[model samples]
Target: MDAVERLRRLCIDDPVDDAADDPGWSDALDAHTVSLVRIGALIATDAPAASMRSVIDEAVTAGASLQEIVAVLEGLIGDVGLPRTVAAAPRIAAALGHGDDLVTDAEI
Candidate 1:
């Protein structure tokens, strides 16, 4: 499963301009934006929560801001609903280093 994900990232998250030969396709969206939407779709489609952390990490490196990532999740609300959004929030937060299960929780 991890290997599948690694391959997916290699293919889907490649920052190279595969659009080099096609003008119309290349004109549509930037590579960073495309990577972000792919991550959003993975989230919306209910991919494993743990798997998303790495995807999110790659998206961040490719210039997708936290706000943009949240927007992608928000866009799914109409189709997937509030419950999914609620569930995904914590996962995303965890990836972003704000999960509730911090060392502070253990200290208390």
Candidate 2:
């Protein structure tokens, strides 16, 4: 299955732990899926100023709505915790806007 589909399945069908324990889970949860989740978590946690701005920019690029981004972050935080969620946020944001300027003068 495609990455998006696999992620959807992972989110809907099985508990995160069940999928995490599966050998193929990592393969299914591709970079994009992970990024989406991370971006979502960052937004939900009221991340650092730089981090929140970065995630918002990335989510906009990734075609993810603010609400969608928030949902993903909430899910990640609910499953994991603040630290991991925070760590993952920037990466996910970066993934969405790989070379783009996620930060702006106004944001800084």
Which number leads on lDDT? 1
The C-alpha stretches of model 1 lying farther than 4 A from their native spots are 1-28, 101-108
Local distance difference test, each candidate:
0.70, 0.57
The ten-residue window of minimal lDDT in model 2 covers 99-108
Please give, for residues 54-96, the per-residue lDDT of candidate 1 as tens digits: 8888788889888898888888888788877666767777777
lDDT of 2 by residue, 1-108 (tens): 455756676789753455446544466565446557655555556556567566556556657664666567557776677776656555545545532475433333
TM-scores for all candidates?
A: 0.62, 0.35
Looking at model 2, the pairs that clash are: 40-73, 41-73
Number of the top candidate by TM-score? 1
